[model samples]
Target: MTETPIHPWNTPQSTSSSASTGLTPEALEAWVNARLDLHHQALNRVLAETDSRTPGNTLRPYDDAIFELAASSSLIGLLNSVHPDKAVRDAAQAQAQKISQVVVELALNRPVYDALSAIDAAAADPATRHYLDRTLLQYRLAGVDKDEPTRARLKELQDKATLLALTFSRNVQEGGNTVTIDNPSELDGLPPDFLNAHQPAPDGKITLTTDFPDYLPVMTFARSHNLRRRMFLAYNTRAFPQNKQVLVDLLAIRKEIANLLGFSNWANLATADQMMESAANMQAFLDELDSASRDGAEKEYARLLSFSGQSQIDACSRGFWLEQFRRSAFDFDSQSVRPYFPYDRVQQGVLATAARLFQVEFHPAPDASTWHPDVAAFDVFDHGTHSGRFYLDMHPREGKDKWFSAHPLIPGIADHPSGTRIPEAALICNFPGGKPGDPGLMQHSDVVTFFHEFGHLMHALLGGRQRWAGISGIATEGDFVEVPSQMLEEFFRDPALLATFAHHYETGEPIPAELVHKMNRAAAFGRADGVRTQLYYTTCSLKTHTEDPAALDLDQLFHSLYTRFLPYQWIEGNRMYAAFTHLVGYSSNYYTYMYDKVIALDFFAQFSRSNLLDDPIAMKYRRTVLEPGGSLPGKDIVYHFLGRSQSTNAFANWMNEQFQPPSTI
Candidate 1:
């Protein structure tokens, strides 16, 4: 394999910017508050130091100080989301709003923007130029070009928006509702282990919570439609009523901000500088994908309907029937394969796969302690030397984000006197962790999710090499950001890789080759409903964000979108958007998941051969695609790596194949 270039911005590092271990609740507030103070001081110093290039410009000091503050803030933020102690979490959460407020204030400061803009950056290093350009874009996006009063209003709006988003997230975390199943008969088709592990209510009935472990299996396996419907409603209705007004206020504020920013709508404003550039472009992209997938999706739906032997379908019962159909057709039972994928074995496989392909090693970071016992630390070594570190906070509890993701905690920087700044990241997920004395086991789909989140973590750990903290580590455009995670799906699908670590937790036996083959063949069985379901989310998001929020009913919009795009009958009284946490973080960009899958597939075509774990291709991919982050345009990076422009042909074919006859594939 050819050696990849060690960019000056992210050379292999040996030091962590975090204290990492033993931060108590009492100290947490002081530590985080002090960091915020330092951040404000650094911003003021940067504004005070520079005016023009007639004299020498020296904002590097400002850059260093700000990044140091960012690193600390990231650690604090990570804790707030997943820390075991409620008090420490409370302090971090309190400090977070303050940090975001300060960040926006400094970023939008006219004097600061002017000072940075005045520097002669044309002749500077690429990273320096990247820093200058990115900073200016952020300032402009924050409304730095507005008049003083307008800017002040925008500042207030910005702070309110930040607080509102935080509020939206917190409501979901603390307010999610749970259900108790007082009837054992309601657990039909559920695994024996599930039944054995979850104790019945005091009245001798099984209890089910809306957590993924409880909710997903019932949706996908339980034969009782009434039970499934109850679970679905309870899960979908979480954070509702409370989040309903929150959404209304948030959408109105976003609209106001967009109008103030000289855009027609919030979607346009949000996508202004992203790869899509406007909501219209994103809509066009969605329209094209939907059109291409419609025929295949229709065929798949017909097959499902026929096999289901039911007159109609709904969100709750589709997965149950689909799994039934899959078993009858492909002779595969997904649940039966679970024992071969204990959570520990799956984690090993994921890390081992990365180690072989990317030439990185992961070792226990006993010193890099975290707030939660569930969170495990790993020191990352590249080329036999310590380069960076990241934490894995697998399994969920109350107050944690429901979805799976890798959050960047610190950016990797080179040539610092404190040794090369090591990148840090955290993987937050909710998989099935059985109660004490029972092993945590994962389904195949959960394994895929693990691989997907690992992609983001790897992107952060390896590609975080940037001189500027603002544009480091998976900071690619929103429309293309899902590519890395989606591309990792290709590896998980390879049966050869699956067999490498898949062994029965009790029997110590390898998964049978026949089972692997059956699973792979049925992998794309749900593509139609998956794609159609995404369309509802993406289209609803765009319309909700761009249209007049006051004139629309959140529930009505959700029902209409579902009825239009999905074959399933919409359930009345369900407020999906109210409980949709993505609406806060992803907002108008939910479509990117489908949009980037096209690009991800196109990228995956480069490694069509059998061995996905090959080192050379992996190294090339790391250098050309991962390391640069968003410093270069996504289009440029795609061309550099593939030697051609990206197109949607690959994704179209992949979607179509699912509906075709088995022999056709």
Candidate 2:
């Protein structure tokens, strides 16, 4: 297999202006906005043309034109943080979002899809025909097959869903716990940095927020079990006041859209393009997992209950007890590891890992125009030619969208390969900020998260033969897109890989082998609970999608369905479903995580049974899976990589082993 060219979207380029080369954020934004407007107008004119059925040969030009418009507009939105004026940034973002919505609508309209189909049928070249067919399928799956009225309704639903998701995330971000700790002794065992970050009022009461930096340390290390319970409840109940209604409406809208598109339910509609093609198949998979795991989860839960000093298990006690047990039993804790995994070191570790695995290079690029000081940019290069550049932004700030993702601003397309180097692609996360006494340190889990998101960055940066924006890296099957990232998480546990980066912040000592051993052994400690939680989410999502919107009690139904796995006497107001972002973002496709995990675990098995840092194996994986983009089916990619059908049995066995107590006990 030929090595793909390093596209500008994947590598970082300098945004700074020099006397030799003229480029400024202000100038770039203005030029981009003008270009976007021109392209938008051109697309509108073409779409409005009396000759809607353009010939196949002519479609490439039209498609290229439309893609350029969307790409430019979206990139401007992403880069708008450079705009000094808040109003300018807001206005640009709104316009860009509007253009994006319109582009989606155009792609999903029947006439546009018919035109693409005609193009596909008439194209003489095999590659051209394949591209057109793939494009046509995407449009159809996006709901282009619907009639005019339904299409209009679908657009409305899409817009509403977008706004609702944004709203829900905002509420969660702003909502945090305001703890009034009367005794400083309650803070015993908590990290000093965490305590320093939050200050007490005149009455001598310290406050805590639901933010991961604040909440995670408290939950993991605080001596007070009652405080941990309070924090857990607060974190879990985010956006509850309004999110319940938002979820209900969102579910109803999705169900209606799915029904209109000829699917039995939203799950079927959502999973059509995924490895698991139907809700029935997903449920069967989950059921098989439950059957395999029922005894294990119960045993773990009983052990946890006993550890918590509780005679009876209850809903609120599970999280608090789990953390306590994990710390006490394993002599391994997130707090103990956090000091060793500084944020900057973690970032370096991830980049270094990617470089070794994929033969790519990353170097920091200074740009004062970034949204925040925490946001850093990097340039990526291919080892062979050293010719391509892409940018990385790795921090969360106010007004920016909340989540972790690799957003490709410039999508690689066949026709527009060298037109405009999409200057930036980014991985955004909400990690803790640096402080005076302590530079921001991340837990081992956070280190894994850093690696996971960079897997997405690599996927986005490594542009394939195809260049269309819509069918780029993560634009593939929602179910399948996670495979690359999930596969990367395996690297976190690799001692060979950790030897390169994992170090103590104060003394710069390497993470101890004994700790690594305990970590590996305790790795499966809460595997059953994690899997069960995921299953509950998948079940709740399917139930919401498959049911009648008007007839359903959304909250009540979700609680009832998910609690089936819960032991009797646990309260119904677990309200976790209310806070499930996947129910909105993934819609009926929460099963993707499970589906992707099967593939990911299978992929991991290839390396786990061999050297984790085996370059040849990693290269084969990149070639077969990461480099394909959406040019081929995900199953084909998996089959090519693994040389067998994807199976969940190994995943089940892994979960069971994790839940099993140490033989020493």
lDDT scores of the candidates, listed in order = 0.78, 0.66
Model 1's alpha-carbon lDDT is 0.78
lDDT of 2 at 597: 78
Which prediction has the highest TM-score against the true structure? 1
Q: Write the per-residue lDDT of candidate 1 for residues 354-463, one digit (tens) a residue.
A: 88888889999886546556678899998887877888888877777676778888888755555677788889888877347667778899999999889888887787
**What is the per-residue lDDT of model 2 for residues 143-171, given as tens digits with 9 covering 90 to 100?**
78767788788788777766666566545
Shift in Å, residue 7, candidate 2: 16
TM-score of each: 0.93, 0.86
Error of 2 at 563 (Å): 2.4
